[model samples]
Target: MSLEGLNMLWQLVAAVFAGLGAAGVGLILRQLSGKRLPRWIVPALGGLGMIGYQIHYEYAWFDYKQAQLPASAEVVSTETDRMFWRPWTYIVPLTTGFTVLDQSNLVTQEAGEDRLVEFILYRFERQHTDMVSHQTYLLNCDAREMVPLSGDNREPRYAELRHVEGSTPLFQAVCPNA
Candidate 1:
């Protein structure tokens, strides 16, 4: 299995242990105090702790990936959103999605007399159900501008051309050939 798959498996195992540990503590407390604690309370507290840990892990996922990335890899942009089930997400925003670019793949291409940096875009999502998408682009090295190309047609599409800005770090890194 891939490293990511292993990481996910470990996270789940840790969560189970955390839940069990919390439940054990609750049982011990009840016995020491000689109080008439409900049996359901231990499992309930464990369930709550497990859910909290899962939320924290999900929210910090971006940072975890970043930490695993190589020095040459950088996060270009990020997208955040909230879900109805995760109400606390509104306060501590979760990185629901993001784009990353590795400078190692930078390439130079000639567009007639002009030299352009061409690279691929890698989009990442927090949800396992979603798949990463790759799109191609060409950057004018001197102008610090870029235009997206159609993956199927292998041609430039004018609809998404723009200047290099703080939001375009992925372009800056992957298209450094320009």
Candidate 2:
């Protein structure tokens, strides 16, 4: 199984444990109160604990993933959004995704007059299931153009080629000497 799958499985197990623990607390409370607490309180507390754990896990994911990255991986940008379903996000926007540039694997080449740099970009998104995708890119310092390379052959996707500003973090990281 993929790391994400394993993480999800662990999360499910943790939530179940949280619910069980909260239910145990509820049982103890009832016992101490001469059984005056409603019979539904135990299950209600269990459900609350599970939901609380899920919320905390969702909010903590970005920081957890960031801490897992290598030293060479620099976060270029982050995306935040407020979802209608997640009302609390409107108060404090949730980090939905981020882009990381791997500096260690950068390959610089001289193709005649142009300075070409090939690098990998890692994109991480928070969804129902966390997703991570990476793609190889070729950047021409002289032309300030960037293009994604496709497949094992590493052929440039001309259709997706676009201009990149020199001041962007990606450009600065890949073409610092340019």
Candidate 3:
């Protein structure tokens, strides 16, 4: 789905959550206003409820997006950053959500008699240019490395090719799934 569409969906969900939260607060205010509770406490509780709903949606945003992704999609990269809160003094008041640092579609290639499959993830940030590299190997379930390849950045051209022989063409197709 398009980014704009996903964003609109999230906005709608957040609105529903916010409305429910505010309505709950209003109900509680009506119940406690005549009792021992002070009149100022009603608005304070409502404000806190709204803030709580906002925080909940913010933290769940990443998970909601991930759940909507296609099964074939692979999350090759992720990032999280710290955020600050002023008045809300609950725990550290810091929140985190995964930024889809990078994603890729698994492509299978046929080279001569051998088959080459690669998961190529590309990240385009707001910056003019950025690069990333990783070391990959076809290992077994026991965590033994096989035909390890050095990390290489994808710039003007793909770095180097390192191939290892195995009993079958599909070697590293194990639990980890890389």
Candidate 4:
């Protein structure tokens, strides 16, 4: 899948989790308060918490991804700003937010003792009626060349290249601002 697809999937997952959280909170509230709190408030709080977690994950996602990598791996470059969403609100006109790692695609090459990996970042913009999205890949590793391995819908999915011997180090530059 493309990075945009991944971002949308993650957003949907987050929203679902948020909905569940809200319902759970409501359930707890109902159990605690016999009179029952306002019907909307519980859901509102849950939504807020869910969005907050999703935003936090969006910003910290790179770090999380990097931590999963090996210590010898070098991030040559990065991509950013690939997906986004806006939900309606009573107090405001629209609430704009973003999703990232849209393509979830990477290219890796070898450089002697070190391995280089390239990451592609996708971006999406929202208008009143439509969403505009695009993609850019970053050669963010020590490797000189990265080749795409597989993809569909004109989007490169997996890539293969040479990697430096034992260069899979824990990635620190997981997320790069496109």
> Using TM-score as the measure, which candidate wins?
2
**TM-score attained by model 4:** 0.38
* Higher-lDDT candidate of 2 and 3: 2
Q: List the candidate 2 regions with Cα displacement exceeding 4 Å.
A: 1-6, 23-43
Superposition error at 128 for model 1 (Å)? 3.3
Q: Model 3: which ten-residue window has the lowest total lDDT? A: 123-132
Q: On residues 1-178, what C-alpha lDDT tens digit does candidate 2 reach at each position? A: 9887898899999999999999999999999999999989999999988988887887898999999999999998899999898788898888989999999999999999999999999999998787899999999999999999999999999999999998988899999988
> What do the candidate models score in CA lDDT, each in turn?
0.78, 0.93, 0.46, 0.50
- How are the candidates ranked when ordered by lDDT, highest leading? 2, 1, 4, 3
lDDT of 4 at 54: 59
Residue 126 CA displacement from its true place in model 4, Å: 16
Ten-residue stretch with the least lDDT total in model 4: 169-178
Q: On a 0 to 1 TM-score scale, where does candidate 3 land against the true structure?
A: 0.48
TM-score for all models, in order of appearance: 0.75, 0.78, 0.48, 0.38
Backbone clash pairs for candidate 3 read none
Write candidate 1's Cα lDDT for 1-178 as tens digits: 9877887899899899889988888888878778688788789879987887888888778887778777866778899987778888888778988887766676787778777877776888877644578777888866677898885766888788888852356645654444
Candidate 1: lDDT of 122? 80
Candidate 1 residues lying further than 4 Å off, grouped into runs, are 1-13, 36-40, 109-115, 141-144, 151-154, 163-168, 171-178
Distance (Å) between predicted and true CA of 89, model 1? 0.4
TM-score of 2: 0.78
